[model samples]
Target: MPVTLEEAHELIARAHRRAGELGSHVTVAIVDEGGHLQALGRMDGAPPLSAQLATGKAASVALIRRDGAALRDMQQAWPALFGQLDQVAGRPILAGAGSLLIRRADTVLGAIAVSGGQPQHDDECAEAGLRGLE
Candidate 1:
């Protein structure tokens, strides 16, 4: 199913709540299948850099339609190609704040990326948000 604005809002809200519970502020970004930004939210305490990273992560997932971790692994296995990817917008990054592809029944609707906390915390927050979609 295509991601609706309401779904995006709920994902954002869930991410916000998870961030608060984890005691970490974060920036959350959602993008459509075409890697277009659908929604973005930056918590008050989140670092400015998170805005870019979050957006990039979301774009990466939307474009690749794969988990960010798998992309990272691919990059690690081929540094040359990965370096080339760096020159491109919405490739992949090692920043690690839970960037993921949003899927429903094998259909990639979009992506969600979170940043500004520990990598694991970011993943947790993103996962929490994605879970709300179900």
Candidate 2:
């Protein structure tokens, strides 16, 4: 089944909880395998642009079926190609930390990303969100 609202919210909550534990505010964005937004949650003190950053990160991972770290590496390896990706994608494609794919068996369920914190902190929050899935 595709990711439901409840599942998306749960992911946001867990990611937020982890962010709090790390003493950071963050925005969490969940997107379906098709790179469509499912749900989003931004903490009280999160920066406004964090919402956009999280969404782009999540979409990048969902669309490519690759984690953010790998995408970041590719982005670094091919700056010119990644630089022009926004035009090709018709949306910002941010290849950064804090993004991950949600999977069941060999199938992808969706993707999640966290922003408004250090890259490592965001990565941790995203991992925490995944751990909460049933």
Candidate 3:
């Protein structure tokens, strides 16, 4: 199923709520399957850089249809190839800790990314967003 605007909003809300619970000010980004930004939410205290980081992470996960950390691992293992992809991808693709593809059954709906806190905290909030969708 394609990700709906409503679902995107739900993802942002859930991620924001989770960030609060974790005592983490964060930026949450939701993107469609094509890696287009659908919705974004930034906590008041979150660092400004988080917005860009979240979007990049979401786009990377959506483009690969895989976990963000997996992409990070791949980048580490193949720096030359990963660097080349940046020119072709147009948008920045950051392999970060808090990106997750949103899938339903066999279809990839989109992706979510959370950033600002420690890597673990960002992942925790992203996980909350995923659980909220279920």
Candidate 4:
């Protein structure tokens, strides 16, 4: 089942809090099973580029059903396959602070992406939000 709007809002709120705690500003994105955006949050100080990056990362994770970074590594290992992946409508996964896959056991529910801060900070914020869902 897809994540509800309320759930998405809570997750993004948690992410915002986490980013604040870490002294970072971030952009958070939630994408549904079809890789369509469900919600987005860009902290006041977050960079403008974070919006698109977060959206792309979330879409990539939802579409691939895996961590965006892992997919990016796979793409690097197989240029031909991954090269074409970038053109596959949400294939080339973006890295940095934004990009996470949301799953329940073996079932992938959706994805979340966070950008605008350091990579580790972004990752931690994303993780913190996901943890709230549990």
lDDT per residue (tens digit) for residues 17-131 in model 1: 9999999999999999988899999999999999989988888777766777888787779878767765675455442558888888878999999999998999999999999
lDDT of 2 by residue, 13-36 (tens): 999999999999999999999889
Q: Global lDDT of each model?
A: 0.85, 0.92, 0.89, 0.84
Please give each candidate's TM-score.
Answer: 0.91, 0.94, 0.95, 0.90
Rank by TM-score (best first):
3, 2, 1, 4
Indicate which candidate wins on lDDT: 2
Candidate 4 lDDT over residue span 20-64, tens digit each: 999999999999987889999999999999999998889887887
At residue 120, candidate 4 shows an lDDT of 86
Which scores greater on TM-score, model 1 or model 3?
3
lDDT of 4 at 122: 87
- The TM-score between candidate 1 and the true structure equals 0.91
Show how many residue pairs clash in every candidate, following the order shown: 0, 0, 0, 1
Give one digit per residue, the lDDT tens place, for model 3 in 1-134.
Answer: 56788888888888888889889999999998989999999999999999999999998899888898889888999999888777889877788998999998888988999999999999999998988575
Instruction: Candidate 4: give the clashing pairs.
Output: 98-114
